[model samples]
Target: MLGQGLVDVFFEDGLNWEADLLEDTRFVMVETTAYFEAYRHVLKGLQEIEEGQFPFEKYIIACENEVSPPKYLRNRRTVQFDLRPLVDENIVIREDEALRRQRRIVNYQFSAESRCAESVEILNLRSWPRPDQLHLDQSQYEALQTALTKEFVVTQGPPGTGKTYVGLKIVKALLHNASIWNSGHQSPMLIVCYTNHALDQFLEGIDSFFKGNIIRVGGRAGEDMAKHSLKVKKQALRKLQDMRQIAGVRFNCTKSMMEVKLEIERSGAQMEASEREILHEDMLRPFMDNCYDQMTCVELPQQQEIPSMMVEWLGLEQMLGETQVAVQQGREDDNLHDKQEDEIALSKRICNASVRLSTVTTKFVNPTIVLTTMPVHESSLLTSSNTTSVECHGQQ
Candidate 1:
């Protein structure tokens, strides 16, 4: 019931539950043909049923281990369990030896009859999702190891080194641990990624592992599934704008809680702006003497000496140069050109440059770099009076 993807269903007619010579009325005797050979739980299971007080035989036929013997160890495991009358809690506990049992579990509440086993016709074990363990390419795997050990991690990266991908993996690791989810902890782990695409990748990874457990705030800023990253950017930007309202207001904004509410009240627009500012400032703290590209090692408490580096060349100075160039070329820096000629030319260049940056970031973002789309950063004017409304979903 837990894992439903790969299922191996075997059907045998005339498996009479009532007609049995194997000597147990409680357990409708299953022939050796029904059992899996090569090494057995069902065999040992039969003995356990006779010794144990509970009528496990009734559940034995109904029981399915999510992962089971030979098939899972070698090939994929896809064993489906067919229950006649659904149980109250359909948790199929898997023995460490096997974990391939499964059930589609549509509506488990409609049945309450005691004679549930009388109706089971066949058994199935399945796993539709290929056994592709979250394959993080070399870089991501490395980052994952580092993130697990470090309390605070900052991967100062350029276009790629799997920054977002690596960050998502850390989330995956946290969620994967049962203790973390059950901890009742607050303060949602913050992930201020580089771009819309990077955020999407993070969300996608999160969804793949956590299902629908997370709540994404700030939508209602754009519409266009094809441009999801762009829309997300607009949503955050709009939130940041709302936050700016609190900038000069007399309200108490020094406290973290107070600032959080103020930003939330302003629709989280300023948060996006702040995130952008962080990335802009990612190059270095202004006027500080340290290079952003290099990461140094800290000494271990027990050792007299220190590890040379936790990470080699963690920072990417190239991002600084590229970002500066792009910012210089941005429409934000251009003069207010009233002439039609200058407007047209400026619009063309901005649009072209945005597109180029979007494309460049796409490849980097996939292998997991954060990136903003062309339209998110700048827009071409269809008309001077254009008042376009980008309405993204999931925002009330």
Candidate 2:
């Protein structure tokens, strides 16, 4: 179970507890905020312990960051913590009832995230090819470590059947169709293939983009990353205004500044207890103005609910768009053999990567077990008793 609470106290340092790990410890992942508090509390508590006061149990903390998924290499259920909650309320715990009473500050990120602990999604592809949705007979991804997911299935097909070329198309289909995490801005899907040859081919199919198309996302994934790359970005700002209903700090900004505003507002990061100076009304006003002028219309989507994963799809489109257009033009400009030439090197690379993922989908799709038989005489198989089960192939 995910342990959450305002840190009434904390413990850290290499764990000194002596217990059978598999039986006693449960796997734990804590947020970054929780991490800081746990460390600080433990450090302080340990110092206090050395001074002959705080309890001894709080000293041995072998805490790891939230990203480190605990492994049971030797059957130890580990605990990880994120102390993001303690950013501003550390020393001031006396005022807050949850902190005073030592209640776990179980926020939405913790609660929502706890439900997805075991079945996290991971990607395994390495490249892309043209016409990404090209269908194979299926079974190409049977060997990839991360490709085998109970939540999803992998398919394999031969070169003409579209195994490599179909990566981006599949991603787009999933983004538009199956995704439950359909945030308007979140479009980060990847189309990895085993070979650069396949990569080039995949690129050839997707880039036939006409000008002035918003949905033809190919290369703009980085824009979203740039827009939101922050130590903190806020979501659910309305909730904070409710939290601050009593102590109203006057603030306003144009619609343009709303992105940055939403980020900070969404974070709800309390800083009152920190050494840093808090933002006064006047000081924060100009920041909004600057952000307003800097904000672009393209950055503001009509859909706020879009997932960032969508951005990757868009980027993939733009990248593939450019590539597909080039391929079409190349076929027009050069000899027909150019397509084969482009594929030869990549086909070889796929051969090597096939230890984990195959290049030719046919190898995967066809059954490995063979039924052996000798060639029989055509006359014996097609005797007059067959009564001419005639099939017509009429031609002019």
**Best model number under TM-score:** 1
**Global fold similarity of model 2 (TM-score):** 0.17
Q: Which stretches in model 2 have alpha-carbon errors above 4 Å?
A: 1-152, 157-159, 165-168, 209-396
Query: Of the candidates shown, which would achieve the greatest lDDT relative to the real structure?
Result: 1
In candidate 1, stretches whose alpha carbon ends up further than 4 angstroms from where it belongs are 1-139, 185-187, 194-197, 219-396
Clashes of each: 41, 75
Q: Which digits, one per residue and each the tens of the lDDT, describe model 1 over residues 33-108? A: 5336633654566656554464433245555434233211234333222322212223222212122124222222
* Predicted candidate 2 versus true structure: per-residue lDDT over 179-275, tens digit per residue: 2333233544445544545444454433321011122122223332322222212333555667676344324344547778887764454344224
Compute the lDDT of residue 42 as modeled in candidate 1: 46
